[model samples]
Target chain A: MKTLKYITLFAAISTSLLFVQCKDDDDNVITQETCTDGIMNGEETGVDCGGPDCQPCGLVLDFSGTYIQEDQMGRPGINTVFGTEGFKDAFNVTVPSQMQAAFQEKFETKLLGLNPAYTSNALGLDASTFTTVLSNDVLWLAQSGVTTYFNGTEILTGRALSDDVIDVSLLLIFGGPMGDQNPGLTSDGVPTNDAAFSNSFPYLAGPF
Target chain B: MKKSKLFAVIGGIGLAVLSIFLISADHIDAPAVQGTTADITDFYAFQGQNTSNFVFIANVQGLLSPGQPTDEAVFDETVLLEFNIDYNNDLNEDLVIQAIKRGDSMYFFGPTAPAFSGEEGTKSTIATSTRRSVKISTRDDVQIAEQDGMKFFAGPREDPFFFDFNQYNAVLSGTASSFNNPGMDTFAGTNVLSVVVEFPKSMLPGGTTGVNQFAPSTPMYNVWVEAKRKQ
Candidate 1:
């Protein structure tokens, strides 16, 4: 019985190859079988169309199937700066659940290297603890409260459109206890967006 | 500033700029995605004007100067912009909102559960029953679509990220001690293609109250944005 099944499989393969050979030999001529075969062939831009015998195919946009992640940003500059040189790409695709475990040690190393002073930050997070927190890299926001990114009063409660994330990130990295260590390295001179944000829905300012 | 502190800052100028792999606020990225539409410039999650709603904004194709042809700076049809929400703090996206450009319109899918999640990416089937769309805004005029208490907009907008790239480079390379008090906004007058969505908090995993027992202390959700390309 097994031998019979194997022979049947071989016969099917041989038959398909024979058909393929015939189609290859028939180049310009569209055999009715080839046209209605439900395969893209013989000048068919799509499946068995846009060719001699078949009707022209229209553009079909299929928004389906799996996509590959090209870039991911949660907390600004986390991966760009903290992710070691060769591992930034890996960090981009790493799932947040595994980010801490996958990149925590490396993040810690980068953090200390960037600031060898090696102490707790404005958030009062020690070197190891701070890197662990940052390694997760997901932007945390609260449903309730004034939504602002790292305001002196509110911390990580969603970023407002006008939030100065760069300055905040700088302070946390260079600032020490009480958030006032390096007055210079802490805040970037550019404080706000060039244009004012809108008060209405879709609040980003219109293009220049 | 105190004289001694000023001196210290001045003295540190020569030692400040280190050759760190510094990129602006998620701009001018690594070679793989730097110039691609999949390059995510910034992700800003905030409260909407109507405090009842939460807004998620993802900006891409960063640093579009005024001189560049605006029409040429369009969203890529093959790129999928996905905002992932992790409600339970397990660091996995429990729900996602995806936006993609098709023809002249931009389609939005989900605020619903994801068909697939995590690093593997998703398909258009993830849209489920909840879907809304708007014509892609090509000019200064805003094109917005509102449906079922959700608002959607995709268009060119002033790049909201403010960074002094040159000064930052100097500081990193040990050439400058600190950033200037009024440093240049490298992104000034530039534009970014932004996808904005405003939806009621009730649409999220924990509903309007947003009290997730799993994460009682922090935000009900962990949000991150990713730009994925059709394979």
Candidate 2:
């Protein structure tokens, strides 16, 4: 009976000691909150040298090219007087062969050219027998627009869907007429003059 | 017999716990220099005209505000900048050009072979015959009217990359309807560290033989730069 009692006492003490040591060890394990500001040691303060408050690092990989155009006073005019026919001619878009075929199949008319007369009426222009020579000039400007290519890739072939090209086309026609047709007008009311193109490619001559 | 067996089991558990603690202590004590390094921002190599010379640039201390330009904040004196050149066909650096800054001025040390790789503490400066030294110039090359040849600058400059970050974030969050037609530019006005080096084309193995070359061009060369922080 005495041996049995001693054995029980030994088992209880050993188990209690193991439980206490394990609990102490678990408590010492480092957690994120316990680490000082995410820094593991005093020698290194933060992930970055200046700490978390430091401004983000900057890297510039490809920095090249130059802008060409820069004359504000001699800026070109945009020609917006073009009706649908004028838009098609000025843009010089060769509809993708598939799109052309699809459009023809749907319309059932050989849509060879877009008609300016319909576009003029659609835009609510004064098409009531208004045969002004300036209007004709504006129409001509829209019909014959220039195309620009970058690195042999036709970025803006003729003048389809180009805000800058369209704006310049309108400016070329209207810029000269600003003071005459509309009195007290210095230039086109729109602010087409900006440094976006200039800063990118400095060697280029002009946006127009 | 059962009592002796129980004692042995307890002793084994104690040894296991002690071993775990000893192993973890070593990981907690990694050296500082290996722990705190960062990516390099810019690397430049170009030739100077009028002289048969070249310049090399490697910049660090990136994205600093205009206000922080003159602060005591400088390159860590201990950190080394190495310019590795593969004079032979192999990718390993056969020649190296190194620079370190001291008190507002930068000092160029060599185009020498590395004595040690991935280890700390400066090794013996390789033979004097293979080393050349130059002091950094104060003029900003961006503003300089003419660089007849000999010039080197490595420091912070306005970032020249253009990306529309706000639009990108908005798109990622599903709040934006669609990306702008031409897209927005987020990096329009920022800064980065720049390193510029200019050397004569002749000094290289192939001196502009053809407009383009096929092999990594030891004789004829195209160069790119990188910064390696000690891992």
Candidate 3:
């Protein structure tokens, strides 16, 4: 009887030990990814930049803050007008390489639709060439020489801080052979910035 | 200001590529980030004050009222302010200048060779060669810095884009034929986060050749800005 009692106690201890050593399939410990994983699986809107493991997507990326691109502006007003009301997200996110092929046809149709009497604008560019230029969606800078969005002789070279770009753009789109087709449409007449541009390095006027 | 007349336009994304890149002045158009920290209001490239330098100004997070704090009115960290240069007229970015904000400082990565290019950008982080942690100010105080022939400033500025959207809309809807002269300043009384940098013309590689070659006949250099996020 004593021998049997000792054997039973050993069996019980052995069973307890086996239970303690058993593999834990139910114990789930997830190894979280560091911010450099290049995967958006984490709380990131982008890879490693956004979520609880990293920074918030709304902050700027330079400071280790998370930011998803919200907006982009190349040449002013091009995307605003030429792009369809539904094309903003694609227009804003598109790389310039694909912009022309993707949007040129739409831009052409819209240009003619807006200016039905379209022949050649003041720039002498037909609707096709003009929209071709517009569709690429870039701001061309003259670099070494005189830079203005359009100072009559040069068209779309680049923009000066005080350049009346909206007026120039309006004229290019609406102004006909004489450079004055539609009297009222050609100028927004908000000719200059509300404040004088700084004559120094950063040029933009102070914020109100 | 007629908030109701504001263009109720939301953008569409055709390709949801994993890579990262963003740009263009599509104000109040993007449903995801319009008038928020991610909004890109304007981009300007002109001769710098020194004349030998070229300046690139990219403004974002538009339409803030005056006296707004940076905590509330500021640049979002996720967006990379990139200045893409296509000197050869091919429209491919031969060089890129990337600026990002951290705390009070703004760091610039490169005007160097881009690791990956195009709409699907490889999210490469080049170690910063230039950084400006200047004191940011609103109205009177102007913060500026210089390094390796490059000048930098990042802060709040006046909204420079002026348009008569109401008239443009009228014409679009066939309610009117043309815009009225001195019609209206729709963007009046708004502020934007501005990042201005001036770098030596020599830093720009020759379009036909490569970096620092000033080809006299090359005449035109196409410039565009992008706001990219790391993917």
lDDT of 3 by residue, B1-231 (tens): 111221111011112210111222356656665656666778898878787889998888776677745325766566678787888877777788888767656667667766556654424454354333344554666778676788888888877767666565555444564567667766666778889989988888654423112233536677887776755
Best first by DockQ, ranked: 1, 3, 2
TM-score winner, 1 or 3:
1
- Ordered by lDDT, highest first, the candidates read 1, 3, 2
User: What are the lDDT figures for the candidates, one per model?
Assistant: 0.75, 0.29, 0.66
DockQ of each: 0.31, 0.01, 0.23
Give the Cα error of residue B109 in candidate 1, in Å: 0.4
Off by over 4 Å in 2: A1-208, B1-38, B45-55, B69-72, B116-149, B165-185, B207-219, B222-231
Relative to the real complex, the DockQ score for model 2 comes to 0.01
- Measured by DockQ, the strongest candidate is 1
lDDT winner among the candidates?
1
Which 10-residue window in model 3 chain A sums to the lowest lDDT? A22-31
| Candidate 2: clashing residue pairs, number | 42
Here, model 3's chain A TM-score works out at 0.65
Put down candidate 2 lDDT per residue, A79-182, tens digits, no spaces: 11121121322211111112222222222111111112122221123322122211211111001113221113332111111123322332222223231221
**Clash number for each model:** 7, 42, 22
